[model samples]
Target: MRTFNMHEAKTNLSKLIDETVNGGQPFVIAKAGKPLVKVVRIETEAEKPRRRIGFMKGQLKVPADFDTMGADEIADMFEGKSK
Candidate 1:
């Protein structure tokens, strides 16, 4: 990793970013000889595999009455009758 002072970093910001992105090399930016931040490239979505639909179709289950399970208490809360 190469170290770039504040001024040099600002002067070649785009070039540095390109090198990091294209060549996958990371560099450090410092101030007064003290390391401040590291610049690196983020992976694009294209590099990540996409999840297929219904990939876990049978991995989960829900009760048939799940929506109505909380009916009474939910209604009481809405009517300000539940504490």
Candidate 2:
């Protein structure tokens, strides 16, 4: 782990973050020669929650007129012709 003074860390924040993320090593930031904080990559793809597409596939049914099912009612409401 490399230690960076507060000034250095603030000056090259982007580069330091890149190195820490790519190299998989945590770096420390120090203030007045004392460690203040450590920066590390927290989550990788495997550690992140994945979005499961179609998780409920086949569990629900769609009617043939699904798209136009409410077309008339919505149009009537929009045109101030609701019953």
Candidate 3:
């Protein structure tokens, strides 16, 4: 990470963005030497989304009544009226 004052960031916004993107580096903008904010690259679409392994592999067990329940019953279930 690099630190830059607000004035420098504003005056050289393009250069700062270029530096950040080219080097995969982040920047922290500060006011009076106190850290304020960070600037970083955005994730590209090709980046695969992370998932928790076995998060639902064997943990999910849908009830037989899952599809048979009416809207009101589903709402009541969500509202804690049904256990």
Candidate 4:
């Protein structure tokens, strides 16, 4: 991260933005010597990685009674039963 005062920030707005987006560098604009805002790249969907299906196959385990394991408890909760 880089810090720039208001005057410098205004003078180099375009360059700062370019550096932030292309060079993957971030910068902070300050007012009264206090940090104000940050400049950063907004990643588009295409730039993001897609999660592949079956990527975690066999990494998890399932019990034979998975479907019915929580059915009774859920029904009781819905029927106003408190335990």
Candidate 3: give its CA RMSD in angstroms: 11.6
Q: What are the TM-scores, per candidate, against the unseen true structure?
A: 0.53, 0.53, 0.50, 0.52
Rank candidates, TM-score, best first: 1, 2, 4, 3
- Please list the C-alpha lDDT of all candidates, in the order they appear: 0.91, 0.91, 0.87, 0.89
Give the per-residue lDDT digits (tens) of candidate 3, residues 1-83.
Answer: 78999999999989999988887589999999999999998867786879878777777887888877687877898899975
For residues 9-70, write the lDDT of model 2, one tens digit per residue.
Answer: 99999999998788658999999999999899878466677899999999999999998998
Give the runs in model 2 whose Cα sits over 4 Å from its true position.
Answer: 46-83
**Superposition error at 82 for model 2 (Å):** 32
Candidate 3 CA-lDDT value: 0.87
Q: Tell me the lDDT of model 3 at 45.
A: 78
Residue-level lDDT tens digits of model 1 in 1-83: 89999999999999999888897689999999999999988876666777899998999998999989989999999999956
Clashes of 3: 0
- TM-score of model 2 (CA atoms): 0.53
Model 4: lowest-lDDT 10 consecutive positions:
42-51
